[model samples]
Target: MKTLTKEMQAAITPDMALDLLKQGNARFVNNLKINRNLLQQANETSDGQHPFAVILSCIDSRTSAELIFDQGLGDIFSVRVAGNIINEDILGSMEFGCKVAGSKIIVVLGHTKCGAIKGACDHVEMGNLTALLTKIRPAVDEELTITENRNSSNPEFVEKVSEINVKRTVRSIVERSPILRDMIKAGEIQIVGGIHDITTGVVQFHEVESL
Candidate 1:
């Protein structure tokens, strides 16, 4: 109910951070949200923001990190893009969030029925979005289980690609950012990936492994 502080953030271990998000999502699914005054939280965090986690998620309206995680203001850093792909700028933001800003964890969150993943699956092209969706193309191509229907129309294929995208993004973050890679290696921070079920309001973490 109170704004996160540096001490609190520092106290969180990688496993603890994962647990916190799990509990938050449990609260979300059950509609048993914590009672907090957002205006008060905003006022308390005005001086500084000590977000506990940095969430790389989609720009999809249904996958808002704050709402899905049931976090309040100054609770988490939300870095959003169409496909949750990592670019130079996004890697810089992650560096700042964990290396400089004292966040404990980084979560690459993808969701079921994600438009971005579907676009990538079907090779949807637009002006600038063409390049953006291209980032997710590897995931679509990596889904070998669903060989027959490898397009967005196949719900299973779409979901598989979405999961692959989350894991790929997680790997890309550590590969692209030396600072973040060092932090993960030194046990100062942790990176994980998850898939959000839009219909169920649940997030399932993919796997736990060191980068």
Candidate 2:
């Protein structure tokens, strides 16, 4: 309901940040969103922002992290890419968000029925996008359970690969960024994964913690 401030951000622990996200998503799914004046939040955060978490999610039009999490402006830092894949640039941004900007949590958010995951499952290629989808290919290969219908059309295969991709991305963040890893090791931050079901408007987080 209120915009996140410097003191509020500093007071929140990593686990508490994750819990806040879970509670926000629950409010979203149940249509119990809190009322906040966007203009007031925008003005409050105009000079600076002290977001508590950094969310890496998909470019899917339906999976906007703020909307689903019911967060006001300056509540969290959002980074988006197809398949929620990780790269050097993403790692740097996350490092800045946590190490420099003081965010307490890093979330690699994948979504069900993701088009990028589907493309990776089928190896869809195009200008620029081919390279982007290639990052998700490893997850597709790692999903050895669904060997029968290995394409995107098979809902099961897509779902498995999507979850795998999120987990892999979570691992990648910790392994690729020493700043983030050190922060996590020092108990200053946490990295986790989740999947957003498009139909249900629900974000089901994975139990595994990549700290």
lDDT of 2 by residue, 1-211 (tens): 7788889889999999999999999999999999999999999999999999999999999999999999989998899998899999989898889988889999999999999999999999999999999999999999998769899889999999999999888888888788888888989998889999999999998874744
**Per-model tally of clashing residue pairs:** 0, 0
Candidate 1: what lDDT? 0.90
Query: 111 in model 1: Cα distance from truth in Å?
Result: 0.3
Q: Highest TM-score, which number?
A: 2
Provide the lDDT at 192 for model 1. 90
Whole-structure CA lDDT of model 2: 0.92
Worst 10 residues of 2 by lDDT: 202-211
- State in Å the error of residue 55, model 1: 0.3
- lDDT tens string, model 1, 63-161? 999998999999899999988899999999889999888998999999989999999998999999999999999998898988797887899999889
After best superposition, candidate 2 residue 209: deviation in angstroms? Answer: 1.9
TM-score of each: 0.97, 0.98
Best-fitting candidate, scored by lDDT: 2
Off by over 4 Å in 2: 208-211
